[model samples]
Target: MKKVINKPEQVVEEMLQGVVAAHPQYVKRIEGFNVLVRANGPTAKVALVSGGGSGHEPSHGGFVGRGMLDGAVAGAVFTSPTPDQVYEAVKAVDGDKGVLLIIKNYTGDVMNFEMAAEMAEADGIKVDKVVINDDVAVENSTWTTGRRGIAGTVLLHKIAGAKAETGADLTEVKRIAEKVIANVRSMGMALSPCIVPAAGKPSFTLAEDEMEIGMGIHGEPGTHRENIRSADEIASHLLEKIFADMPLQQGDEVAVLVNGLGATPLMELYVVNRKVAAVLNAKGIKTAKTFVGNYMTSLEMAGFSITLLKLDAELKALLLAPADTPAFVQF
Candidate 1:
């Protein structure tokens, strides 16, 4: 219950205000709605909008900028935003080129974003969507049918956004997003549970020496739990699962993202990345680029996930394209 906030009900509103205040040049709030659109919105380029809950900061919102998302709708912590909010975002960001929605593979996210797209189409705004289900964890968990979207979604944003920035239409943008989804795979482990502000308690409990494997970002119980092991051992276990599922082979090039959930420090993330790179190198997979940091998060969860995207020439170029956003930037 040790949260630094004014009130539980006002948390999302206050946070959105803070984000707008902090990044006025890159984003602006749509008045009377919990939506953040790029400062220079309604551009002719295919607009990209993605969102879900609020706790995964610098995600759907932090990415609203050039070469990334054009708009983001915010829901309460770990809750899906309403279709009305999403519809407004589509309307606000759509220009002559239409809009694309990058929705994660959660049921609520899928349903809500679909409703919004339908509404937008009713209003004559062309819209398309791509669902990210890149987590190679488990299928048919209590929460979802297929895999859950995790750190791989960030790669989706970058690659799809780059395509859109280059004047790709909605169809092309969505196709590229799906291409990223098909090539990316992710797996995560949690050492400690996250405390949701409103709940005032950890979402789940894990013993001091235990870790949960194949966990989702919302603190849902993972596929299995085991005694905590060394960083290298943990990295091997995660990579083994991912590579088995994806079957990465020799002479393949990939992009690596070792993402800290929230509370884990960069030091530990790099430690995990070291082991991950060693594993990939031993497997004869060449990593063209590596990103080790908290790109995607689950509030204050103490854990991390690793995402690997098998890259082609176009994907590699898009992955290296410049992007400027509040949470991530590359030149």
Candidate 2:
């Protein structure tokens, strides 16, 4: 309930305004719509558009710039953006090379984004879509019919966006995105809960000494909650589950992403990363690149998710390619 804002109902609108206020050079709003597009783009290359709810910041929106998303549609907190909004985004960012939609594997997100894609195609804009289901947590969740997409979606953005930036067509870009979706695996744990502004109450409750393994970003029930463990133990547990799902061999390569769920501190994330790196080294898995920070987040949620992207040469190079965005940048 303690949020800095004018009104709960206006949070998404105001947040978008603030984002543009801070990064006008990178993004601009689609007037009257809760959609953001790259400020100076939609160039003659395959464009990327992805979105879900609004709470997962620096995600679908903060990534609107070169080498990432070309457009992002924002819904209300934890709610899916409507088809009209998504259609607007597709229209705004399509540069004649076609557009690619990177959707998380949530029921609403799948339905809405696909509806938008259909509408865009009706308008003669070529569009392709890929769904990300990288969370090794569960087969189904409150909002999704399959494994929920978590932080690994960001890696999808990076790799596919890089391919698109290379002037790849929609089909090729979508193929790369699907490859990332196939190779990436993620798991998360939460030490505390977060409050949604409109709800004015905690999304879920966790006892002080308990932690949730495989926690979903929207506070959906995870695999189970148990007594809190050390950072190393938690990291190892997450990695174990990931490896179990996608067995990595010694000498394999990967890119690591230690993502914060809004309220988790950088210090804690790094602590988790330390163990992640140690485990991968012990397994002889060469890490190509590592990113540790708040890439995708549930609003004010106190947790972290570890994502490991099994990498081949193509994926490794695309991941390391230059990207300039509000939330992510690499030279």
Candidate 3:
């Protein structure tokens, strides 16, 4: 229950204020909603909007900038944003070129974002949506009907945003996003659970020497829990599962993302990445690019996830494109 805040109920609001205050040049709040839109945007090109619960920072919100999301609607911690909030975000970011919504494959997220899309269509806004389900974990989890979307969503954002920035139409942008979704795979393990402020207790329990493989971001049940193992062993387990599902062949080029689940240190993430790269090399899967850090997180949870995107020329180019945002920037 140790959290820094005036009140549990006000965390989202205060956090939004802080985010807007810190990044005024990049984003602004929607006044009465928990939506954050790129400041002075809705450019002539297609606009991108995405969102979910608030705990995973630098995600749907921090990405609202030049080459990423145009708007983000944040819900309460681990809760889905209302359709009204998402609808407002669509309205704010929709240009004549149309808008795209990048949604994770959570049930609530899909339902809410779809409702918002329908509402926006009623208002004459051309909206298209893509649901990310890149996790190679179990098919159904506590909050989702299919495989949950994990860190791979960030890659989707970058690639899709880059396409949109090129003035691609909504259909084209969505097609690119779908390609990323189809080729990417991810798996995660958790060492510790996180405490939701309002709940005032850890979402789940784990022993000092235990970890759960394929754990969902919201502390949903994983494939199984067992005694913690060495970094190399953990990475092999995760990556092997991903490989079995996606089947990387000899000389296949891929991008790597070793994402922290909030509390894990960069040192540990790099350790995992080392093993990941070694595994890929031994399999003759050439690593095209490597990213290792805390990209997507489950508020204060201790763990990491690895995502591999099997790349083609188009995806590689879009991934390497320039982007300027609060959480991600590349020249």
Candidate 4:
């Protein structure tokens, strides 16, 4: 309810304007559309476009630069972008190498992005897509038929984008994207809910000493709620669920992402990562890389999500490859 904006309906539009203004050297708009593409787009390599509702900043948009996304479409807060919007993004970033759509598993996102793919194909632009179902928390959430993609989608962006930057063909880029989707898993817990600007109300509520575990990014109901627990306990439970879904063994290479949900502090996130790191080390799992901070987020929701990406040599090298984006940059 307490948002600093002129009007609720105009939030997405104004936000996109601000983003382009702040990073003109990195991205540009599609003119009267909620689309952001690399300032130097329409390149010779395969283009990567992904999007969903707004609110999760520095996601599809923040990753729009070299070694990451080529374009990103934004909808209303927690709302899906239309197929036309997505189609325009594909057109704007389209190169001879083709375009790849990195969609999360939400129903609207899947439908809209897939529709755009078909539309592009009709025009002879080769398009392929990979739906990320990395959330290990639930099978079917309110907005998705299967697992909802959460922070793990960012890892997919990094690795797959690096592949595309190498002048890889569309088919090969998609193959590497699928490989990341197959190996990544994530789970989240929230201490508080967020308020949508239009609604002027919190999406959900929790007691002062309660937290929702396995919650989706859009405030969907999670597996269960419990009294506030220690950070170690929470991290352990989340990892327990992750391993239950995909068991890992000694000497396994992996990457860790401790993502903040809007309002969670970096200090708290590092504390949680400490526990995550201790657990992986104790188990003899080799961590190739670890990222901590607000990579993906809800709108001022007090929570965090943990993501694990099982890595091979190819994945490790690409993940650590040089990327220059607004939100994420690595050498």
Candidate 5:
């Protein structure tokens, strides 16, 4: 366990403090709680909150800003935040309008966020939620009940947050989020596993020349493993599976996200995106917008995921809306 840290138990707290120190203009820490809220929060609109384990950097936390999340609760590494912590986030961000919890499709995340929503409702805070299940990896994984939410959740955060920022009510926000979830699909492949500081070991193991297809973010075992191949071949395999599942056709415009799973370099990501774009172009799917970066990650795991969102006019506009977050900025 060669990690630079004071103590494993205090890693999340210290890391968040460092994030606040690094980006004070964008984020602030809630006093005495493992919650990070936008510096200018309680924005008098429908507040958006989402979170999970601490390892997925720039996710629930880096997203707390003007056009994305209002608050994000952090748990221990690769562990869900407690219900009470989530309840605090809801209370801290709720205003005259309401709050919307953007929960991913994981068992622990769903359960804890749901419990917090119930607690918030008890206090007369109008709350709605959208569970993102965009990963088309597998039906039943050990980590989640249904399909796991992966990089596609970033698009959900963007589109839904844009709607909420426009003063959409809880019902409308939830509707828009569901619409995004319905149209988006994602698939990921892992080149290497990540080592959780607390665990002091890699989550999983892979051979030097092997890759895990359809892997989840938590380093869960993927559907299968195979000898590593060229970037083009991997992109083709991923797109084939995603397109087969979603069935996009000619002349359909879509937003594409080629996300690095923490450790993959930008150069490699661009190479992968080249192949993804070629495949989509050949299939007549017009690439309306493309984002290639580490929007969502699994610690320092070496891998990437591709997300495709079939876009309508409404989705296009919302997706293009201005967003000012730590990791993503669109204007």
Candidate 6:
């Protein structure tokens, strides 16, 4: 229950204030709401908005800038934002080209974002949406009906934002987003669980020498728990599941993301990436790009997740496009 905060209930509000203060040039708050919108305001192009619970920093909010999300709604730790909060984000960012909601596949996220979209539509705003189900770990989890969206959603954000930056229409932006969702697959493992601030206790427990594979980001049940294994073994186990689900073959070009859950060190993430690259190379799959570090995370959870996005020319081009955000920047 060791945490650095004044009060659990006030964590999200204080965090938003800090984020805006730190990055005023890039983002601003929606007055009294837990919403972050681009400081430059809405554009003539399609607007991108995505968010979930608050613990996964640098996600929907840190990604607000020139070439990423237009707005991001934040909820309590591991809880979905209210529809009104999401609606405020939509109203703040929507331009004539319309707004696209990049919702993860969590039950609450899906419901709340969709309700916001409908609310916007009634207000004469054109809104389109995409639900990301990139987690190959499980079919139905505690918070979602389908696969839970994990780090792969960040890739979707990059690709979709790049397309929107090109003045693409809403339909075109959503089409490209779906392409990324279709090609991407992710799976995660957890060494230790995180403690929600309000709860002041770990969400789950694990032994000193045990790890659970195919775990969701919110510390939900995974595929299995077993004695801790080497980095290579863990990487192989995850990659094998991905390959079985999608069957990546020879000559296939792919992008790899070795993401830290929260507490895992960069050294360990790079170790996992080394093994991931080896496995891909051994299968004759070409690695087009490799991203290592924390993209999406639980609240101080000890583990990592691997994400693979099979790439085509269009996807590769957009993924490599320039982006300037607080957490992710590409040139």
lDDT of each: 0.91, 0.92, 0.92, 0.93, 0.91, 0.93
lDDT of 5 by residue, 67-165 (tens): 889999998888889889999999999986988898888889999999999999999988888899988887644554788888999999999999999
- The TM-score of predicted model 1 comes to 0.97
The residue-by-residue lDDT of candidate 6 on 199-274, one tens digit each, is 9898789989999899888878798999999999999999998988899889999999999999999999999999
lDDT winner among the candidates? 4
lDDT of 3 by residue, 211-264 (tens): 999998887878899999999999999998998889989989999999999999
TM-score for each candidate, following the candidate numbering:
0.97, 0.98, 0.98, 0.98, 0.97, 0.98
Of candidates 6 and 2, the better by lDDT: 6
Write model 2 residue lDDT over 94-205, tens digit each, in one string.
8999999989988999999999999999999998899999999885445447898889999999999999999888888988998999899999989888887889998789
Regions of model 3 farther than 4 Å from truth:
140-144
Q: List the residue pairs that clash in candidate 2.
A: none
Per-residue CA lDDT of candidate 4, range 1-331, in tens?
6778999999899999999999999999999889999999989999999999998997779999999999999988998899999999999999889999999998899999988888999999999999999999985445447899999999999999999999999999999999999999999999999988988999789999999999889888899999989999999999999998889999999999999999999999999999999999999999999999988888889999999999999999999999999999999
In model 4, the worst 10-residue window by lDDT is 137-146
Q: How displaced is residue 192 in candidate 2, in Å?
A: 1.0
Q: Cα miss at 43, model 4 (Å)? A: 0.7
Clashing pairs in 1: none
